[model samples]
Target chain A: MSWLLDNFTLVTELALQHARLSAVPIVVGLLASISLGWLAHRVRAARLIVLTSFSLIFTVPSLALFVLLPLVLNTRVLDERNVIAAMSLYAIATMLRGAVDGFDHLSPGVTRSATALGYSPTGLFWKVQLPLAGPVLLANLRVVSASTVSLVSVGALIGKGGLGYLFTNGFQRNHPTEIVVGIVAVLLLALSFDVVLVLVGRAALPWIRNLGGTSPT
Target chain B: MIEFVGVTKTYDGGAPAVDNFSLRLAPRRITALVGSSGCGKTTLLRMINRMVDPTVGRVEIDGEDIAGRRPVGLRRGIGYVPQDSGLLPHRRVIDNISVVPLLNGATRAAARLRASELMAVVGLDPALAHRYPAQLSGGQRQRVAVARALAGNPNILLMDEPFGAVDPIVRADLQQETLRLQHELRKTIVLVTHDIDEAFLLGDEVVVLRPGAQVAQHGTPADILADPADSFVAAFIGSARGKRRLTISAQRSVDGADRVVVDAGGYPVGVIAAPEGRLPVADPTPRSRGAQVVG
Candidate 1:
């Protein structure tokens, strides 16, 4: 307990750095996934290809993906950027899956009705499809965010900044308190992001709450 | 006015859904396309607004061929309502209704104002405008869909089984509401349904399609009942002709003399005269023997 109180400031700083690392990659990954997913949906023939490629990327072992990035990019001295890249790759897989799921989840009747109502393809995607996909998109965001928070630890192997750094440092120094603090902080961050996502979904997408009160998967 | 000139649609690797169909939908009148499942009634309806383009022939609206026009522009001028309501789940009732107007360049406020008026036009309570589709009942959702179709105030409205997902009572109410709207608005309408009774009730001209999307018959309800083009239509009209006859008889009243009182069984229970001031009691037995009317 004394150990915890003494290193509270150091732990808090590490936690913040970890959150930033997770957040940056998640944001980038989400944007890319949504854009790519929407493109795949608009082009009927590209759906299978886009989905398969993303699925394959997701199947690659996380450690292997991170390890290979430096080799592929022809760079050494893995730093914060390596952490971001590794976390972002992980997030891309989840977000792409989520975006595809959101697109497929839309009722065909709605698309038909939109077309019948004279909505152009663009209008239908923007006004009908995207808005309808909100809950699913938000849920995807939560999953990706949680995954990034946990996976950011892979950065410690390459000497990057985050709570993962604290874990590695504590392991080398034989301090269990630092490792426990890092693990607990990450779990709390993931849970908090999930709760915040739910609240945002409920507030911004009241239809989701009204539709059987089941959050999007 | 909408004209279909030999329109044919063949799904990929499948038989033609609509086979060289040709028909005209007169302005300000309701035309019902009735057929069995996969009979291409829906495919035919979609061609009116170019939701599904014809592979062989052309569809015209207001005497202009819609082939060269951008499908989006063409659709913007035609109101479409489909079965299952098809309201955007995330949008409030009012926003859903305003979709077309917004597409047509109406300001958000203007479109919203029009949407509210349409909500009333379709017989929905004004308070429902703020509710999302998920919050509404099936019947209410269908009403909202109708209201949305009317938002652009287009001269042509196409509905494909718009009331199919609702209960019978709600379906009847929606049909009545559609008729009332037609009376007030006088837009050209084409509706598709599998139910012949619905076609009779709603259509000024009923076109019956066969299994492969061939047109079996096209005529007024009275004419179709009096003389069906073939046995397919006869069977399709079902054994409920007696009830349909009563409805037709009631609608055809001149000087209010066609008095027909039908029981819940749809059999004539009594006959009375109002414009002729004659009240006569007919046989109360159900008319199960023949198609002829007894006075």
Candidate 2:
């Protein structure tokens, strides 16, 4: 408690950085995944290849991939960009399959109706397909967000992971307080994001609020 | 004017679904294409908007070949109602009804206003417009589909068994609603159904198709009834099932009025009032909805 009080400014700074590190990757990764997922849905054989590639990337040891990305991108090992880019890649890997499933989750009957009613291809995607898939994607979003928050700590291994070096400092100094604080911070972040996601999802799909057998929850 | 000139559609070199079929759909009238399942009635209906293209024929609307037009543009001018209603589960009823108008550049407020009018035309309550499709009953959803189709104020409305999915009571209600709508809007309507009675009830002209889109006979309901083309036509219309043999011989109670027609065995087969030395003119007092009357 004394340590936190004494280092209040540092704690708040690190927490803010940690939140940014977690959130930016999620946003970037979701944008990338949405595009990639749509391509997978539109093109034959693209789904299998994209999903398989993302799965393979996910299987690679996080530290090894973290170490390897800097050399490939020609950036310094400890640069924040390295952590952000690597975390985004991880987020994309985790979310790509689920994103594709979100699109496939659209009802065939609805799609046929849209086409029959003179919805142009672009119009259908914007009005019907994307909004219809929003709820399912939101469920996947909460899961991916929690995972990203935890994974942001992995960047501390390379001296960039936010709130993660607290555990290291705890280990080195034989102090349990720092480790507990770190776990509490990450858990709090993840939980808050899950609630925000639910709220945003409800706003995005007002029709689903009263709909049953539609929401996964 | 919509004409199918020698239209033939085959699936991937397989046998023809609609083989060298041709017909003219009269303007602003209901023409029903009725047959059993797989008789290409649906395929023929879909060709109007180019949802299904005929392999070897030209479908023309107002002397313009439909194949030459952009499908989206072509379809926007034609209203379509499918068997299952196909209302988008995620959209509100008003949004579903306003889709066609929205696609055609109507402002949101304008589109919604038109949609409300269509809802009334289709016998749906304006209050239900804010509800999602899942919240409504099956019959209400079906009515919503009709409202949606009519929202564009389309010159032509194509219905592919629009009432097939609802209960018989709802089906009868929808049929009456359609009749009322036809009386007002008078749009060119092409209806597809397997139920012969439904075909005759609503169709100004009924084209009976056989397997492979063969036209067994095409005529008015009365023409088919008074003079069947063949045994196949007779069976298809259920004329051979003692339905045609029915004579206006007996009487039974109808709607608290003492005018109802009974069959040869004194059972109330229908209600018809034949004035002395005159043909039967069905007494046109609006009977209760869903009551079946035959002649």
Candidate 3:
């Protein structure tokens, strides 16, 4: 407890770094996944190829990925870019499948009617399909966010671990309290991301709330 | 007028869905296409809006080949009501109704204003405009679908089993409402239904279709009922079972004022005012005697 108080500023900076590492991959990966997923959905041939590539990418171990990214990206092993790049790849590998499932679950009637009612292809995607797929998309995003936050801790092995540095240093110094603080901080950060995502989903999709209840008429 | 000239639609080299079907839908009138499932009625309807392009031949609106027009632009100028109402569950009723107007570049306020007016025209309350489609009853949802179709005020309306999803009682009310709306709006409407009775009641001219969209019989309700083209048409209309053949049976009352129209099974169809003076008791063949009382 006294050690945590003494290192409060260092702890805060590490926590902030962890938050950024998690958030960047979550946002960037999801955006990239949405486009790839839509392309997979619209073109029959693209579905097989895109899904296969992502699945293969996901099977690659995270530690190996973090170590290997620096070489492929022409960056130093200790650079933050290697950690961020590795996490972003993992995010996309998971989220691309989620995005496809989100779009696939929409009712055929709604999409058919949209096309028949004069929606251009681009207009239908933005105005109808994507909005309807929000619940599932958000659910997948929550899972991805938590996983990304935890995965960033592995970057500590490469010297870029945000809060993960505590685990390595605490082990070397034989200090269990430092390790516990790091674990607690990561869990709290992941939880906060989950809560924020849920709130965002509810705000964006009002019709999902209070279903079957009638308004005054 | 919408015309299908030698139109034939085939899927993946299989049997033709609509095989060389040609029919002109008269403007400002309702034409009901009555057929069992797989008769290609839906395929034929979709071809008009270019939802499904034909494997052979052409469809034209006012003699202009629809193939020349972009499907999105063509569909905007024509109204389409699908079987499930197809209201966007995420959107409020006003938004669903105003979708097309907004797509066509109307200001949001103007589109919503048009939506509100259509709600009144289709017998929907303004209070219901803020609700989501899932919050409304099945009947109300269908009314919203009809209102949405009319929002653009297109000259043509294509309805594919628009009332088929509701209960029988609501179906009857919607059919009546549709007739009333048609009387006022006078748009060219092509309604697809498997129910022959619905076709007879709502269609100015009903086209009975066999499998593969063959025109089994096409005539006014009265003409088709009175003279079926063949045994298939007779069976399709249920005339072979004497279900559609009604006979007037006068029941005695203190005033002797009501005659019951009954089918062959002796079920009362409806009551009509009794004819003046004595008539043949429970006349069975009134139509040949030129004293028909029921249709």
The number of the candidate with the highest lDDT is 3
What interface RMSD does candidate 2 have? 4.9
The window of 10 residues in a row where model 2 chain A has the poorest summed lDDT is A208-217
- Point out where model 1 deviates above 4 Å: A39-49, A212-217, B239-295
For B91-128, candidate 1 gives per-residue lDDT tens digits of: 78899988888889999999999998888888899977
**Backbone clashes in model 2, listed as residue pairs:** A155-A161, A156-A161
> How many clashing pairs per prediction, in order?
0, 2, 0
lDDT of each: 0.80, 0.85, 0.89
Which has the higher lDDT value, candidate number 2 or candidate number 3?
3
Task: State the DockQ of every prediction.
Answer: 0.54, 0.40, 0.63
RMSD of each: 6.7, 4.6, 4.4
TM-score, model 1 to reference = 0.87
What's model 1's overall lDDT?
Answer: 0.80
Least well predicted 10-residue stretch by lDDT in candidate 3 chain B: B286-295
Tens digits of per-residue lDDT for model 3, A64-126: 887788789999888999889988988988889989988888899999889999999999999
- Which regions of candidate 3 are displaced past 4 Å? A213-217, B277-295
Error of 1 at B264 (Å): 16
